[model samples]
Target: MASVHPRVPESGIMSRPRPRHLAPVALLIVSALTLVGCGSDDESSEPPVASATEAEQETPGPDDEPTEPEDDTSLADFLRSAKVDDALVNRLGEVGDANGYGLGEGVETSLEERQQLATVQVGTCRDVAVGHRTWEGIQASDVSSGGTEEQAAAMADFLREEFCPHVAPYKEAPLPKQSLGGPEEDAKGGRGLASPVSWWDTRYRRVSWSEECAAQTGQPIGDPVAYRLSDDAVVCATVPPAEQLKKHLISVDVVFAEPVGEERAQDAALSLLPIDAVAEDETEGTNPDWSYLEGGCLNLNIQSQDLEDVVAGLKENAEPWAHAVHYSDGATADGAVGPYTGEVKQVSLSTGRNEPTDSGDLTC
Candidate 1:
């Protein structure tokens, strides 16, 4: 019974990704919800503060750039308020009105909670011109516990009837495994969900250069939804059970392509971590994950839960060009020596004689 509110700093609140997969307790009300930095529900909360390419561009001369559009307060308000009705007609209307899109007549919206599903759809013409952006894309969840059969069936129905019909014509109904969020646990039979993780709290880039090559070459980048569906998405890896760590070092060997010096490697590893999680500093209440990168070899100690998950994600998302990566979390080994067979013979160097020993042969 709590609403997701942005956790802001004292100075101001900056838009960040919505924690759609947030655990219930994480949805508890914070101090106040502000419209100043809030973004639409579909938008990632972390709006990019600055762009590298933009910085490199020389300041636009007075004649080079047109007058920038003025801030639309009402439109901003609508984006900030981010509300949905039972039918979701208002939501659809608001989006269409804001973006000048159309929802064909006779669209039905029956299922209420199905809006949270993660999906990819063809965006506006502008989106296509730049790159195919995720239209009305929701955050995909990793914490879902697969809802009841009834809930699953209803979601399937919604996908077949509403989503596939109107949103994505080429997309098929998402299997239960693909459902982003899941059923609420009853006290009698369910375990409580874990605290929310802020992995998805990332800056959203409006324009994409992914399809730049295709656009330049006059080639199709294929269906946007299909492309996204087939794309190799790296998700958080499942942690092994405690028993799996019987006699293994909970470590990982990461080899960078070019040998980045220890200092640079350490810094790069540190940058991948969240602000709250500690690395070098061992202050009070500090949960640190150690990494020592030498000669392009990053020997990591994946002790903390956050660090373990992060390493798992790295393994999952590793590019083909990366040097090498090996995990030892759930690794096992055998102690017995090699099985060998050999004939036993005694050779006397002084006499230059070879004689068969009492031991006929040896086998191990």
Candidate 2:
């Protein structure tokens, strides 16, 4: 997302992320025998787009496993066609794939060691909240959810259970937070787009945001099939419904040490997604899920966000992901508050040479 310039003009299609279930539609021409089976199936003529991370986490699906990958295209290919990196792609793909069985899901790459391990998991729900990254290391075996001070302290309880106490949990720092300033404040605790937005359109849809660190799962930074966490920390958000949003969640099980040496721990990821394996009508459309199903090695990264973003509902830049937005559709005007966060650390009003100060680097 940082690659695209702020002032760059957008075409008609790059506009919005709304009407999630929109697709090409046409009445089916079924055979005589096929007509009978139609009574049992309720088919939708619309095309399926990516689901949000919040919705997926609430509904359990295939995204919670590390060994299984949906039989669909890699998340990278999909986002690359849209505009993003492979690592981000893998992160988003898992979100789109989550259907049932997996809770939080997505791919992450990291090194493992004997006594310590660093792991990350990500996921996406239709509308629960934006995506996120998590960090887990030598603290895994005895790790705490960090839900609350008391919840974190509970790890010691398991350690003292005289019956069986081989492993336990411990408290760690809470995940970073983003300052709130958007529509999401009413429900979740993620950040929002900066004021005064700018807009655009892509692929015949209105896609707008000020800043986005989007992840598109299915492609690997080095591996694939990430995350297989259980469904404890997940909660459902409304924008997307229960069933449609359930198809995107990939959880990573990175039980390996971050400072991995000769004896590295094995990491795994598992997920259930909108496989769309059988395209009943070839003329109708191309089922997007076919590509990711053909799998590869899965990575479990211990990142700074949620357990599922395999489909990128909300991805951010740097480790401490901040809330940001992009504009689309005629929704934003030029010189808007959005796209405010730029990598441009330079001043432009200078003549022959630019002066530099503590403010930032200046360019003529």
Candidate 2 has its poorest 10 consecutive residues by lDDT at 195-204
User: What is candidate 1's CA lDDT for residue 179?
Assistant: 27
- By TM-score, the best candidate is 1
Error of 2 at 32 (Å): 34
| Candidate lDDT (C-alpha), each | 0.22, 0.18
- State the lDDT of candidate 2 residue by residue for 1-364, as single tens digits: 1111111111011111111111110011011112212111124424465468756765666766555755433332322322434443333233222311112222222211100010111111101122221112111211222122332233223212320121111111222223322342112221111101111000011111101111211111111111112221111101111122221111111222121221122111111111111111100011112111111111111222322222243222212211111111001111111121221111001001111235332110
User: What does candidate 2 score on TM?
Assistant: 0.14
Candidate 2 has an lDDT of: 0.18
lDDT of 1 by residue, 44-149 (tens): 4455666777866856776886769875343223222333222443443333222222221123322211122111111121232343221221111101222333
